[model samples]
Target: MSNKDIITLLHGAGGSYMHSLIKNVFMKLNDNYGEVGLEMLDDAAVINDTVISTDSFIVRPIFFKGGDIGRLSVSGTVNDIAMMGGNPIALSLAIVMEEGFPLSDLEKIVDSIKKTAEEADVHIVTGDTKVMEKGSLDKIIINTSGIGNRPPQLDYNINTLRKNRQPSRWLVPTNLRPGDKIIVSGTIGDHEISILSSREGIGFEANVKSDVAPLNKLMLKLLEVGGIADAKDPTRGGLADLLNDWSEKSGLGIYIKEEDIPVREEVRAAVEFLGMDILELSNEGKVVLAVSPEYEKDVLEELHSDPLGKYATTIGEVRKDISGVIMETVIGGQRYVGRPIGSPVPRIC
Candidate 1:
């Protein structure tokens, strides 16, 4: 809704276009309730200690290797609230379906939503459904809004994940500082590669599956151990966009070791074949954290204890020497990790 009269897929890719669109259009009629609004641009909005977030899912194929649009819808909203250090309590589901869509498929998708919500310890308290004429839309699209509450005793202490400096808010990327260690919850590019292989017919015999999962429990465990400065789940823009946003916001550079960042062999193979950078692809379940070195070991231990984070690794550390994301290559060289401006793959959550 900028100067252009039409909207493109890039406007929803969670990159520059999406950022600008949100700022220029939807944000113009802003009513953020004074304390919590759209300005922070964190994962969720917090008002009076309650956290809330909403997201729409239009992933192609509707069903994929490890999840469908249904699961993605729930996890997307729930994770947004959790990233803000809140325990998700409930969600509202709305669906738009094209006429002639299979009823069996709808049942399966709804079942997936129920299962994921149960696993994430939340409920779908309300919902709505609408059907469109044939060919008017895709098979189905889902929108979810979630609400949560910060712990009663949330504070800056070692037991709490909330930052002491920003008592009014919880964890945010801008809270990062130099010398803080960077950690990724698990392997990158698995979800994107899985979708590509299954949907694009670029099947890799290695069997890569989507990492579409909820990260609330994993994050809760880490928050319990404390020392975390900031956290973000790398979803739409992958690790590159997430890191670049952190850099631009904190006015600091993030140095990640290429050898230390985790990536599955199959994912790497697919990325190489497609001539794409794994860093630019999207991930659904993984989280990136900026933690203080003092508690890095403890935080890693906590993450490793969770099944979702068994492959967690300390990938890098925040730096003040520069002003952007720099990755130390395996060959002992450094390169700038820039933001992805266009959508590499469309309709990817």
Candidate 2:
């Protein structure tokens, strides 16, 4: 069979391949009925100041060290809405399970979903459940759809930053300019590494847990501080794809310092041992922000104060001279970082 004749995991890995699939196949429908729709490719669609996002979770090893698929599903959808600068209000959940699946495990997952929703301060207003033939499906799969409202703080921040210029209606990825600072929330690669360690049973000396948690509260705090131009949570394609997307969309360049980007020592060791690129791994609970230079200090300070962003630091700045992602290595050398074809690790939510 030819390459186009079949579907591969790369098409779902959230990188170049996935982007191509979405643009060529799904986008053909082209039904954009909202402010930011499929064409704009923002975190979520905004309709009449309300934001909505939908996602499906299929991470292997339904239960992992730090969280289960239930937590992952809820956190993923909540973060998507938060990235769009919306305050999540409610969520709708749907689950499909194979026949003979453990009832105890199902109960555990349901309880986890309830607790996570409570933590995010969002309600599970509706849901559905279905059973599949045991041989036709894996253990289970989850889908979540979330609805959010625009917070006044986000509007105030955008208005304050854009003064004379027309401000964006929502936190779009392309709202970047030269001199804008890039800040990442805490460390990277923790989620993917934790998944690998659990699935492959690679017992590293230092225990690493998945950093999968809802970040709506942390995002709200940043909005309160003001001056954020755009925000995104680096997930399936990790930081490389996230940076590349920003550069391509904004028509600008990003210069990031390798030393400034936070990565846990344990995650680094595992990546090196596995011969994988840490930047191409997934992160479930980290966010990347572009802030105006004037508010960079305040934003970083606010992140430092939050429990979820204690390790947050400035990693880079947007540039007008260049037009792609450039990384300054720890040894003082520079290298061009391009978009990956797919994530090095797959099925990692």
Candidate 3:
């Protein structure tokens, strides 16, 4: 069969292939009446100050070291809304379970969902459940749709940070500019590594857990500090994909320092052992922020104060001299970091 005749896992891996599929196939159906819509390819759609985002979780193993599928579903949706500088208020959940799925496991997942919602201070106001034929589906899959209100802090940040330029209505990826500082919430590759270890039963000495948690509160705190030009969570395609997306959208260059980017020792070892690129792995609970130079210090301080961002640090700065993401290696050499065709690890949140 020809390449276009079939669908592959890469189409949903949140990398170049997925983006190409969306632009080529899904954009044909673009009928958005919102400020940020399908054409924009943003984290969420903004309609009259209401931000909406939807996501589906089919992570394998269902249960992982730091969290489960239930928590992943909630955190993913909530973080998407937060990236749009919105205050998540409610979510709609839909679950599909295969026939003969255990009732005890369902109850456990529901309890996890409840606790994660409470942690994010959002409500699960609506939901649906359906059963599929035993052989027709996996154990369970969850879809969550979230709605949030554009908080006043978003406007305040734009005005305070972009006093000389025209400010956009909401935080978008293309808002990055030259001199803007790039900061990551914490270590990368933890989530993907943890999943791999669990699924493959790799008995690593270090206990690397998935860094999965709702980051709405932490995102809001940064908004209050002001000067956040753009924000995104490094998910399916990891930090490399996120940086590439920002660079492409803004038509600017990003200079990242390999030493500045945080990666745990265990994660690094595991990646090397598996002959994989750590930058191409996924992270579920971290965010990458582009902040104006004037407010970069304040933003870092705010991040340092939060539990979710205590390890946050500046990894790079936006530039106009180059065209793509360029990383300064630890040995003082530079190399281009491009978007992966697909994540090295599959089914990773």
Candidate 4:
């Protein structure tokens, strides 16, 4: 290990530690990978114009209310590719297993991965496995690299999401207009709550399941109807984080009707009882689309017809004010919705 400090879990996260690791080791070792792919630091890389995304799954308490790490491993990478305006085709999986982990659990995870790949209509075209000394690794850590074909139209990168495309990777709010409508593809908060329950062993009156599913199909359908300015799954930062990123990046105000934001009643109540902001909660199988105002109804009609999009809701609309993100409170007042404050939840993605 390096002499600096004992690496923590966050190091592997797609944030600072990951960046430092890449600059120090990866970039230094393979100079050719260079600026473009390394700078992106996205879930995948684009090469020869191919859309590629990668993700490492280290979610503890792997087995959760709705799904497990196995399923997450595949969907996470595939979704990352989808976000890039690509159609997922294949994935490369890698696993680091701890010496004492159960064989049965490993099998289950592998089986789940295969199932997910099939459901997403992608294949595990390549992979590698290694066993670590006991206690060398958390039960298991999975890394996946996914490759896809870009939409024939204009290409979109994480650059569009940035506060400003020039300096960093962020959501681009510049494209959003005041009258543009916010459409949520499905229910929210299921993934976070499910994982939270598993981690904390929180008991609930009703069973909560993960909404982790392949979104490639739904994303394709949306494209069939009309062009979408933006499409993000609202995974880690939750819907609130996603919208806030958009509003802040674009310098436009956003108004979201709390009622129209889709949520399962149990999830809403559970989240409310825990005093969590539904907007700040994470989701696994949801898509947020920013569509042109004129096509809002037409898109909504077609989306509603889709079983996956049946729960589609017009949660809000972009605004002309520059106060960033705002919400019409349930009680009829308004509140300045801020990004997530602390570790209210971790490993949300």
- Indicate the residue-level lDDT of 102 in model 3: 96
Tell me the tens digit of each residue's lDDT in model 2 across 1-349: 9988788989999889989988888888768788888788766889898899999999988998799999999999999999999999999999999999999999999999999999999999999999999899889999999999999889888976786345577888667888989999999999998898888555554478999999999999999999899999999889999999999988899999999989999999999988888778899899999998999999999999988999999999999998899999999999999898998767899
TM per model?
0.94, 0.97, 0.97, 0.82
Q: What is the lDDT of candidate 4?
A: 0.73
- lDDT of candidate 4 over 1-349, digit per residue (tens): 7746676654543333445666677765554462236544344556665777777787868888778899999988888777655788999999999999999999999999999999999999998999999977888989988888766433333332233224222212355666778999888888887787677655654467888878887776666665356667787657766787677656788889787788888888888788887887777787888776766887788789887788998898888855777888778988888766422665755
The 0-to-1 C-alpha lDDT of every candidate, in the order given, reads 0.85, 0.90, 0.91, 0.73
lDDT of 1 by residue, 247-314 (tens): 98788899999999899988888888888888888999998998878889998888888889999999
Tens digit per residue, CA lDDT, model 3, 13-45: 989899999898989888977899888888799
Off by over 4 Å in 4: 1-47, 153-174, 203-206
RMSD values, in order shown: 2.3, 1.3, 1.3, 5.3
Against the correct fold, how does model 4 do in TM-score? 0.82
Candidate 1 worst ten-residue window by lDDT: 152-161
Whose TM-score is higher: candidate 1's or candidate 3's?
3
What order do you get sorting by lDDT, best first?
Answer: 3, 2, 1, 4
Worst 10 residues of 2 by lDDT: 198-207
How badly does each model clash, as a count of residue pairs?
0, 0, 0, 13
Name the candidate, 3 or 4, with the larger TM-score value: 3
